[model samples]
Target chain A: MHPHDPEVTAAITALDLFAGLPASALDEVTARARVRTLGRGARMFDQGEPVERAHVLLSGAIRIAQAGSDGGQVVLRFIGPGEIFGSVAIFTDHLYPADGIAMVGSTEASWARADWLDLIERYPRIALNLITIVGRRLAELQDRVREMATQRAERRIANTLLRLARQAGRATGAGTEIGFPLRRKDIADISGTTLFTVSRTLNDWRRQGLIADDRRALTLVSMAGIGRIALG
Target chain B: MHPHDPEVTAAITALDLFAGLPASALDEVTARARVRTLGRGARMFDQGEPVERAHVLLSGAIRIAQAGSDGGQVVLRFIGPGEIFGSVAIFTDHLYPADGIAMVGSTEASWARADWLDLIERYPRIALNLITIVGRRLAELQDRVREMATQRAERRIANTLLRLARQAGRATGAGTEIGFPLRRKDIADISGTTLFTVSRTLNDWRRQGLIADDRRALTLVSMAGIGRIALG
Candidate 1:
């Protein structure tokens, strides 16, 4: 769709990079964007592909990951609505480092590389905002590295749950439910533990009444307990 | 020395963030910068300090690290000549996430926060360059996390040595010498192993003639062998 579409303008303006741009500039950006809607498990971009555009998720979620030579996949992060991904290519080498896959139904607004670079040049604040965003991501990634290096599997999983809860938790009758659709393997991959370990830990938590778990959702029955475990 | 000093101007212009600026702009940046020489083992800034300036290392090396509450220290990475450090604080919450310590006799050129922000406003390329730097850093940190999660101690240390060799390796008669003052504890910290493990591994490597080690220098005697271990 054309960037001039009202829907596109609203979405683009809401983005931190495009926020505060003049209406005319926003119109220009909107005019230069292409929007795509994808089904669950659809691949948005492949690792090592020349990154030709920057994407802003309009709705739903996207998983960014890298596949190892041994067929093991590491989930780098999950991008939710209003967050931009694949834009790192604009500032550095123009190649995607990981595969961007759609999680659930997703809508993405994309801008061509040249157009996005032009916008950044015309609006320096966009570049500044991007630096801030990238810096925060780096800091978070470093924290994950530290956790993986020093923390135990239990503490790692506990911290990961708390982090996910903070990002996508919803209050429910049972407890604070994690709003994301996460599988056992996702938790295992994220926490650097085996699937069996995650399963056994969750079973233990269920028995202890520390958490309520289902196939697709998890409820933190006792955040204090989880915090204690995370601290340990 | 004044900002117009040929030495300062030359150094400033060499930085990636200032690479393409006009001489007049370089002079302006130089005028706003303060150059300091730090002795070996000097502390540049502590983690959690309010970031007040951006620094560009002109000579020697700097080590950036974080200290744990339990007195464990993690060596994040080392910065060498012409690389910018301590600038991540400029874009985020203005707080340094790690301590910057001088590894050897080091000369750094620094700009106050306000002046650096003004410089970035006047030159958008600086912000773009920073994005590239931070993006690469995030990618490297992610690799560290993945390694810590999936790799064993031997493979992790091997990979760490390879990385450091790539970053700061100096060709010598014995082999490709890593040009940094790395202790056993430093390698252990970087590889998330213990000093005992690192020392044992080094002793094993020395016996196998796979690496040449000393108190202040480490030479890779066989990159092929190290690569094999790292691949495992």
Candidate 2:
């Protein structure tokens, strides 16, 4: 399919970024965007690279993370379909602040920075939407900062699971399972803990019958149980 | 002074928020803004409050923070003259996500949400500048998240002091002093460390002639010393 295929435009129109935009404006957006597909474990962009495009995920799971000086990775967030990423760096000094890695096979629509900037100027509503998008992310990061300062490892991990479940949880026969394949290391990075602590915590939660895990896919067997821990 | 005073217009023109706007547009901006004076210890806004207005700091020091469910506050950032604050929360669900408090007597120019939105539409440059401002803050938060996930408290504290110094440092006889009066608790909150840890770390730095503290004021005696610690 071509970049300007109606299917792509339909997909773009369905995204929150294009919410309330008229069809012609959507066409403008669709015309300028380029589609990028990534295999599992492939990175969309690395931190500190000059940002060329702003992206919106079309499908699959991608995790945004930052690497420490010690070579450890800290997951900033996970993105699924219709979510925006890499745009935040465009308004900055033009460098991606985090790495966007595909957790699973994924496809995204990307617009060159100049085109995106012109699009935002021509359609101020899109600019407003982008502002709201960045604002909410800032709020999330603020919450993480507060939790890291005040909460212990267990509570942070519980809250992290709860948050991921809410953001991308899928219902199953067992319970609400996190939609994406999540590893213990991702939880460690998100919760500011260690792999060992996450393993130990998951083991404890498993024994208590609060969760069911098969490899990466985890289902919260007892939302109430996890909620109690998160509240604590 | 009246809200439409030329002094206010000049200050508004000088702000990074209104960068690249023409004189008439600046006048329009000045006309819509209301001057607010906050005494020391007063809060500009609290978390979860409806965002009534967006603000630009005209003078004095302010600290932005968020309170966790445990009733602990984590300092998110510090603001000085010509810097923007409390604006990030405007575009999100209309609720402030953090608290902005005056550390000293402060004067600010605020525009009601309707007015600010109108200004952003009328002058897209302001909107662009706002994007850059929020983007930079987001990048800072991302770095803090990574540091919280990977660094020890001592290194985090060093980075915190370095950040504060860069944001609002005053070159004095001693060194580059943090422009605001910061207590140990605030430092702890900013660094994601405890007051005890901050106290111990400050003492260690002071003994090593890295910093000088008098009451609530802190002066970084050696930027090189702190930079080395922060890098670790």
Which candidate wins on lDDT? 2
Q: TM-score for all predictions? A: 0.92, 0.95
- Measured by DockQ, the strongest candidate is 2
| Model 1 per-residue lDDT tens digits across residues A1-232 | 5566677678778888776678887777788889889999999999889999999998888888876543456877778777889889766778888899887888899988888889899988888888888888887776676777677788888888888787678889988898767888888887888999899888898899989988778999998998888878
Provide the overall lDDT of each model, using Cα atoms, as 2-decimal numbers: 0.83, 0.88
Instruction: State the interface C-alpha RMSD of candidate 1.
Output: 1.8
Q: Look at candidate 1 and tell me the lDDT of residue B66.
A: 81
Candidate 2 global TM-score: 0.95
What CAPRI grade goes to candidate 1? medium
Question: In order, what fnat does every candidate score?
Answer: 0.56, 0.72
